[model samples]
Target: MKVKRPGLVTVIVDLNFLNVFLLIVSFFPKSKFIEQFGFYFNPTPSFFGGYN
Candidate 1:
């Protein structure tokens, strides 16, 4: 059996997307949009535990 890895371009794009997502979350940590996004991302209360 053989395992396949993501190509360099895919990895780079994923990292870039992660960076931009983090930037947006950081810039508006207290905004309703972030809160809603976080909830949908992880419905657990601990999702935003540190922020509180």
Candidate 2:
């Protein structure tokens, strides 16, 4: 179902998500931060860079 929110509210939400995504994709401990975002699809450190 589609719900409608005020334009200003939608923009704010999108900006928040973008900021969070950028933080997760940059900096050290990226894996830890991404895991915290509830995105379980990314491979963990053990499975990354062929360590697994």
Q: Report, for every candidate in turn, its global Cα lDDT versus the true structure.
A: 0.70, 0.72
Candidate 2 contains a number of clashing pairs equal to: 0
> Any idea what lDDT model 1 has?
0.70
Tell me the TM-score of each prediction against the true structure. Answer: 0.45, 0.44
lDDT of 1 by residue, 1-52 (tens): 9977679978999999999988877765557786676533433355657543
Report the C-alpha lDDT of model 2 over 1-52, residue by residue, as the tens digit. 9999999999999999999977757654446666686655544466546743
Span of 10 residues, lowest total lDDT, candidate 2: 39-48
lDDT of 2: 0.72
TM-score of 1: 0.45
lDDT of 1 at 1: 94
RMSD of every candidate to native, in Å, equals 9.1, 8.8
